[model samples]
Target: MGKPTGFIEYLRELPVDRTPTERVKDWKEFHHHMEEKKLRQQGARCMDCGIPFCHTGKLISGMASGCPINNLIPEWNDLVYRGLWHEALDRLHKTNNFPDFTGRVCPAPCEGSCVLGLNNPPVTIKNIEAAIIDRGWEEGWVVPEPPAVRTGKKVAVIGSGPAGLSCAAQLNKAGHSVTVFERADRPGGLLMYGIPNMKLDKKEVVLRRIKQMEQEGIKFICNANVGDNVEPQIFLKEYDATVICTGATQPRDLPIEGRQLKGVYFAMEFLGANTKAVLDGGAEHALISAQKKDVVVIGGGDTGTDCVGTSMRHGCKSLVQIEILPKPPTERAADNPWPEWPKVYKMDYGQEEAAAKFGADPRVYLTTVKKFVGDEQGHVKELVTVEIKWEKNEKGQFIPKEQPGTEQTRPAQLVLLAMGFLGPEQALLKEIGVETDPRSNIKAEHEKYTTSIKGVFAAGDCRRGQSLVVWAINEGRGAARECDRYLMGYTDLP
Candidate 1:
């Protein structure tokens, strides 16, 4: 404990965000960093709990309770509080390969499980983490460190998302030649396209990391679809080993009346194309646009929130988000407590923007889309929804049951289905002859990561199903460690 009373003296604080109305005007990041001295004070709020749950990295109640990468949170907090930023960055990099991405997008399970949160607000761990990494970049402290010697072993990584990138980076650090294949025009799979630019600046953050990885001797090949353009046998014959980080890209579809409507689209098709157009020039080539239209988003997860935010930026006339689950409580219920993700009502950025523009919280819980109504041109014109209740089925599983006499219809020119992903696209897995689990995810045990095929391993969403980017990094690093052992009969990478 740097100062025994530091936690008592300092309080939790974070960077202020730009006003929703102002930030919605442009697709740029809104959260501004706190001044350095203020940030150090925030870092001082760390209590140095003897058994710090903030870094436990355990799965409690089926959700991550702390830093999944097992970041040295307390050590770095102490370092930053003492004005040792360079040392803080070093401690952060010891575990997380890319704290920049997590600092922005992660839901901060660490804060939720912080011991201090039992009595007061948790330490501003995520903000401190982001500040340390951003400072490292500004000071030119983050640079390529290619291995001094090559191991004469080559590894092929399919997918350029966080998992594949982390895997390839770790293998390269161990002196193995690594090549990443991405089907998109650019690398950084979800980071480049799936996520909004305002949350993570692609050019400044994602591409910068890619550039460093390139300088570190990791090769990235774009526009290469492994199952279609490039044959799986090529990797098997050419590379010493292969790692499949092809994330769960298959979106769950809403099978309903008028599903073939023109304006109705999957959330990724909308988010991916918008990001592409943003990078290319504007939304000129965007396949779907919500401009001057009533937008209805199905699902209430992060992806749905993203859809709402994107629609607001497009100047949508009105917006409504529907979720089948009931609304969470404003505060944690007696059944729910700290050390687990609080199932409490909290407004995300998208909801905040929607409220600012539309004069209401757009989310309508316990409601589901029943059908879509389209105009003569087949473009969606309205959405039919109904209230639903959870009831036990014959098998004792809770299922959504539509309530009678509760049908409602609303104007909606654009309908975005952000119901989440099903599993990895099976074409590549089928081509590679890998077995799949019951959920259709590539069948690989956690940490073991080895697929049925010899010298072929799986990690990330493809293997474990949809999860956080931090979990992807964890699986990627674990897969690399096992792959290294497989290639050289021993391993050092972690």
Candidate 2:
């Protein structure tokens, strides 16, 4: 603890985000970095609590309690406070292979479990983490560090999402020849396509990491579909071992009446195309445009918010986001105690942008869509919605029950379905002959990562179901360690 009483002296403060109204016009990252002095002060606020739950990485109440990758948060906080920037990065890279990604996108469950958060505001751990990694890049401290020796054993990693990238990176670090296969044209699976550019700049942030990985001797083969273009049996012929990091990508669909109407798309279809358009030349070249159209975004999650933001950029005439669940409380509920992920209400970047432009939050709570109304051309024109209440069924599971006389119609030209994924697509798993759980996720033991197949392993959303980026990294690293042990009968990966 560089500053023993620092927690009492400093208060939590984050860098001001670019104003919503101004930022919506351009596709740039909206978050501004804090100055070094303020970042050091924020780092100093890490308390000397003996049991620092900030990095405990436990699941409480079925949600993440702290850093899922077990990041040495307090150690790096102290390192930053002592003005040891290089050492801070060393400690950060020890656990998280990509702090830059998690620092931008992770919900920061670590802060929810911070000891200082019992009464006072928690330390700005997320901001400090982003600062540390961003600093490392600025100072040229981050570069390729290929292993000094090669083990001659080759490993193939499927899917270039967070899990696959981390798994490939770890296996490469263990001196094994690693090759990553991506179905998309680009390497980053979710990070490249799922997230919008304004949230995380693709050319500057995501591609930069991809280039670094390439320089480190990890080969990436793009547009390679194992079950289709590439043979699944190639693993047993060439690679010493295979690791499946293909993510949960099967989006849940709203199969109500008129679902076949035109102008309705899944969130990934909209988001992925937009990024591809931006990378191709200009956002104006997007496959589907929301310009001058009334947009209705279904499902209220990060993907929904991304749809709202993307629509705003496309100059949509009207925007509304529908959430079937009730609005969360402004503060933590009694049942959501400290150290648990607080189910508190906070406007994300998209909602803030919508509120600034539309004079209100765009989300409609306690509402469910009954059906999509189509025009003569068979394109979506409007949708009917109804208010609903949660009721327990005979199985003791909560379900939404629509209220009578509450149905209403709203005009919409474009509809984006952003409900969460059900599980990974089954084609590749079936071809690979890996067993799946009842929930359709790959059936591999959590820490062990081994599957029914002798040389095959699974990790990330494919194994654990859809989850946060940090958890994907944790699973990927764990799978790498286990795979290394299986390959050599001794594991050295951490």
Candidate 3:
């Protein structure tokens, strides 16, 4: 530890963000950077516990409890606390290939499981991480380190999202020739499209990294969809190994009445189109503008929150997010103890922005849209909703029972389906002859990352179903290590 009593002496602190009203006007990052001195103070808050659960990367109750990439949290925390930023950056990059991405978007289970959090607030590990990387970029310390010699073994990675990028980077470092294929016009799959620009700036942050990777000798091919635009057999014929990192992009649909309404759209379609428009000179052809519209977003997850934020950016007249599940307690429930992820109610950035714009938070708990009410032109104009209560059915299965007299109709001009993803589309997997689990995810064991087809591996959302970006990166790194091992007799990759 940098300071023996650092945990006791200092408290947790995070960087300030721009006001919601000020940030909504443009597509730029809202977070303000902290001064170096203040960052050191935040870093000093790291207890770096004897049994650091933050780096364990274990699963409890089917939820990730710590850094899934097994980041060397304690070592880097100490380095930052001592003001040895270059050393901190080195340690941070030792495990995570992209601290910049995780530092901004990750929910930070590390802080949730922090030993200091047992009594006081946890250390600002995530902010310190971002600071280290940003500093590395400013100082020009981060440079391309291509492998001294190539192994002459070729590998193809499908999808240029976090998983595919990390896998390709690691494999390239291991001296294998790696190429990434992206279906989108640009690389970074969901990173470049599914995610809104305000949360993660595309040019300043994401593309900067991609440019660096290009310099590192990793080849990226855009507008290439295996089994569609490009033949699947070409990979098998050309490359020694293939790793599929295609994310779980097949969105789950809400099969309710008036689903064919014109104003109704999938969350991905809206977000993707918006990003594409923003990148294409800030104007869209089929503009799905929320301006002056009463927007209702179905499903209260990250995607729903993103829709809420995006709607606010478009100057929506009003907004509401419907969640079927009951609201979580303000604090952990009796059954949920510390070190387990705190199942408490918290306002995300989008909700915070919505609350600032409106008088209250937009979420309606224990409610779901029964149907969409559309005008004569088949444009969604309202939503018919009903409150529901959970009860055990005859077969002992939990079912949502509609509460009588709770039916109501609310004004809505636009309805966004933020229900979530089902799994990877089956067509490509079928064409490639890869086995799938009962869940329809590519059949690959955790850590091993091997498909039923030899010399072919699967990882990320496609292999493990819908998951966090951190988990995807973990899967990518693990899959790369396994792929490298398969390429050679043994491997030294970690």
- Residue-level lDDT of model 3, residues 404-434, one tens digit each, is 9999999999899999999999998988999
On TM-score, the stronger of 2 and 3 is 2
lDDT of 1: 0.92
lDDT of 1 by residue, 1-494 (tens): 67778789977777789999999888888889999999888888888988898998888788889888999999999999899999999999999999999999998999999999898888999888999999999999999999999999999999999999999999999999999999999999988898999898899999999999999999999999987899989988999999999999999999999999999999999999998988899865677888999999999999999998888888999999999999999877887787887778989999999999889899999999899999998888998999999999999999999999999999999899999999999988999999999999999889889999999999999998999999999999999999999999999776
Regions more than 4 Å wrong, model 1: none
Give TM-scores for every candidate, taking all chains together and pairing residue i with residue i: 0.99, 0.99, 0.98
Computed on alpha carbons, the lDDT of every model, listed in order, comes to 0.92, 0.94, 0.89
Model 3, residue 484: C-alpha shift (Å): 0.6
Model 2 lDDT tens row, 1-494: 89999999999999999999899898999999988888999999999688988898999999999999999999999999999999999999999999999999999999999999989999999999999999999999999999999999999999999999999999999999999999999989999999999988889889999999999999999999999999999997899999999999999999999899999999999999999999999889999989999999999999999999999999999999999989999888899999998888989999999999999999999999999999999999999999999999999999999999999999999999999999999999999999999999999999999998999999999999989999999999999999999999998999
| Model 2 ranges with Cα > 4 A deviation | none
- Give the TM-score ranking, best first: 2, 1, 3
Clashing pairs in 2: none
